[model samples]
Target: MLNAMSFAHTVGNIRHHFPGLPTLLAKATPERSGDILAGIAAKSAEERVAAQCALADLPLQHFLNDQVVPYETDEVTRLIIDTHNAKAFAPVQSLTVGELRNWLLSDEATPERLAALAPGLTPEMAAAVSKLMRLQDLIVAAAKIRVVTRFRTTVGLPGRLSARLQPNHPTDDPAGIAASILDGLLLGSGDAVIGINPAGDSPAVTAHLLRLIDALRQRFSIPIQSCVLAHITTQMAALESGAPVDLIFQSIAGTEAANRSFGINLALLKEANDAGQKLNRGTVGDNVMYFETGQGSALSANAHYGAGGLGVDQQTLEARAYAVARAFSPMLVNTVVGFIGPEYLYNGKQITRAGLEDHFCGKLLGLPMGCDVCYTNHAEADQDDTDALLTLLGAAGVNYIMGVPGADDVMLNYQSTSFHDALYVRRILGLKPAPEFEAWLAGDEYARLMLEATHPERLLTA
Candidate 1:
């Protein structure tokens, strides 16, 4: 099903980008090598190399070997290689706009395939897809060239806080809901991070996190590594009050929120930088994480209001959000999570899959792109459509995703499909699926059996 040479070329490209992985592989034992190879086999070659390098403890150059030659090209491999090489070197040399256009209009333009496959596609839909593809191309190009004149890498805290849970009325039993979500995350073999939105200087939320930490320790033997707080002042207070705050950060929802929060954001950053100066003195060490949110779908009332009536047009909103993000780069360079949902509700209207993909590629060049809450319709629904959507998103370079299960009845089933899609993406990215991943999702006895078959060493390495 896969062309080996093309696969090799992609892997080679990944190796080129991250040069510390091969040494890690070389240092692994036979069993570890097998495990690593299995992991790599589960993902795309490029992703496999990326993950390896990302997690590797070695220096960058150790994984790179300029003398390591790739297998010569076949037709498919040649095309992929040319495209890859062109993309890699385009900025330094010459890559014509015409060439880029032709590439999109080619058979590989994802929308063309979707049109042939999805009965829902119309001519207008096709045009939208093309526009998104071009826009993504432009954004990626711009990100590659954008210069950073200022480096205000430190972040600060706000004096207050605010919080909202989606579906407005979250389950009355917040503890039960939290447990279910965390259980799914720990049990599932996917990367998971919890985001806490503690509003109004409430100590209750801090207590809730304390309970979570205890539960994780007692039940799962997992350590609470960090917390991503939406408000800075509350974050610092939480940290001071024995909360395991590994990284200090802030969250921005939309344009108006950006404007309203800009002063606060800057003030907090300046304060944090100032504090770091006093604490660390002459030495420079980063004790905080700074993340800026780009434009996202108005999934909540607050988000809608905060975004200042930015219409639900994906392209326009994305452009505006990107402009703000670029302007705030100096303040947000520590870590920036780009756009969230073009949620399913507005799927055909404001944001299309293609548009989301383009926006992601554009904003997440050097930063992490957090894939916002993944909500699907149901398992009984057309999962192939969902799979196609996931495929498109993955191809556009989404490394972090928030997967919530059982948000609704349909979402429960959809969560299963989401896991499947995640596994598929993992394979495409060259990451190995955990053993018994399917069985665990199926809720089989094998699930518990596989849990008992844990390799603590592997878990430690991971």
Candidate 2:
């Protein structure tokens, strides 16, 4: 059975972090949150959850309907777009690194502004952006951002690594989902997160999956948590049903209205954070939020980084995505760098450049960065392209990578790192999982089995 009392204690601790949540929860009696108390051992888990919900007077529905900010055109960018002067050059789209450097340094140079146009830049163009920048530029940019790399309020040990166990399926089959999770864990991959984005939008489906994950922990004997990447309201339904949900997952954009359009705002996020804190499923630290972001989420919602609809360069907006993570202690923050295909990157070169650039930027700004070193069928890339980038990112100190079955996201239809790929990186770079998880994986049959398969020399021989 779940520890309701322990959960209550964690919930009480949440107010210490988010000072704004107390008033919304002020009505509870006995100096304890009634919703958290409902989860105490005196009541069966279900009844306690119901009592808690009733006591809190919580509205467990997707209710935010904010507007997306419009993109604004900047004057310098406007003149270039209007005059179309670059089109006269020799296929300006295919410029070399030297050519790109000359172009940026030529007239009214703005490396940051020009860098913003990178999503539309070709691979060659992105390479120039990555290599040619002066250290001062990155130093200047890093100084402006606020970030957090550890669990809330700094409690993580460094020189460790983790991976997101992305167990997803098209039909949302419980057995299939369980099998994939087994695959990832056996390969030593669930350190950062063990979560799923349910293919179906039904609350029942999410509840069913959450229960399956809860039951599996004992059978597998591993310390891990699950995320049903459903609507926050849907997750609330599962939470009401008394399922084991560790973190609330969402894809946040840059603008407020856009986040609301996706049914989340600061207030809603706070409520979810408070509830997760109360649940206390985190094994690494106290953070209970997981977020996935890519460039263009803001514009996709009709919000622009600027006032005149000229979109903000992706780096600025992407950094803004990292900035918001500091609001809550985020356990995992993935910048799906190349998942959007070449439409933004234009080729493998640009895709590779963006992966490294985003990783460096997020890390410098204090985020535990994970790269979805992935590519779609439409992208001008293959496994080899991603493999090279993965090695580089591993060398660059990324906190984690995505662990899917065979590196194939059957549900999302994107190709990423597989369980074996995680093992490969670990073996080559001498990296290990989070300390506690490594202890849990210690001497288990599955770990032995994986060892025999991955490194037969580690096995006892006659």
Candidate 3:
């Protein structure tokens, strides 16, 4: 909860950024302010959020001077905004869902800008804004930012399904990592990003894995890049060791403290970005950041409350994390949606819901969205649950999926989609792997397997 004056000052930066807000907010009268606050109590969660956006649009000093109400909880302030600015929202309210969808399809709106504006809209209103556009709109907006990432390899998404090789090992052994990389490539699943999380946590170990992945990529001469998920400092060490690193990877949280706990700061990220840009090894421009995020990281880190104007549901906080990823211009953002387990997500139903929500939010905000399609040992989930999530996201225009050995993560002790799963979805939906890699696979021993995987009837005869 914020005092009227403090809340105003807090999101003042946001207000500053939203053009024409001051003029728009200047028209609210005292009587309407009372009605707006009164009306807010009865609305749904989406409606309440919409109302809050209206209040946030006003000048704090003037709004405080009016002291429309005692300004109790932030929710109160939010509802008051809705009550006060009913007229502004009236136009939104009156627009049919189809009309809003068509408007979004037109050149008049963008996912990035709409994301910035969505916090003030009800989910219904936001849906009205994006119902038809959904994955298609998200893909376009994300590609605009996704294209400039470091080692910018386009995943050939919506056209071709993409998969990553997560050959994580307990010791970060080069042999073990290389074997996993080869396995994924053989399975036609390394098109997303061939990366590892060095559980050993040693910069040297991370560097070794980085070297191993790059070496294999070159040895096979496949069109791919590598990610080593270590602290920026550790990755920098790998870079200093002359490892051919393609992407800078980090696990980001929704708030500043949680992000700091992960040993990341904007300054540190900028330094890594600078280093990655210097590598400049991709045919695409310098979009190089790779981020993995889950819903509970902020709550786990105890940084959920500091989200400022960003609402505090798991979905909102998760989206806020994507906003941070956007700042660094990441090429890929994986919402480890179900990987956090039932402690945060409860059951498969909750997990599935959160996965879809996170995907929609991330893609809507224009991050090259991929889903981990994962679950942990402790989660009340199974292979069937994961398959459902994988299929759902695939249909939703996902950019990539993880390709771990047999869909099992040895180092992290989680269950995620495997190379076969990628094949399953692609074969079912007629999705291809990225063009360059698919072409490479076509020329080799993989040609038969690729063909069989494409048309399973061939497998029965073979």
Per residue, candidate 3 scores C-alpha lDDT tens digits across 158-199 of 457788889887777666666676667777888878878788
Name the weakest run of 10 consecutive residues (lDDT summed) in model 3.
Answer: 26-35
Clash count in backbone of candidate 2? 11
Flag the better candidate by lDDT, 1 or 2.
2
* Residue range with the least summed lDDT across 10 consecutive positions in model 2: 59-68
Candidate numbers, best TM-score first, in rank order: 3, 2, 1
User: Which residue runs does candidate 3 get wrong by more than 4 Å?
Assistant: 1-152, 307-311, 444-462
Per-residue lDDT of 212-304 in model 2, one digit per residue for the tens?
766656554566667889988788778877877777887765556556667777677778878888886654467788778775455456543
lDDT of each: 0.32, 0.57, 0.61
Query: What tens-digit string does per-residue lDDT give for candidate 1 at 176-253?
Result: 435433444444422223344333344456545534534443344331223434366666666556554444455533
Task: State each model's C-alpha RMSD to the native.
Answer: 20.1, 21.5, 11.0
TM-score of each: 0.44, 0.64, 0.70
lDDT of 2: 0.57
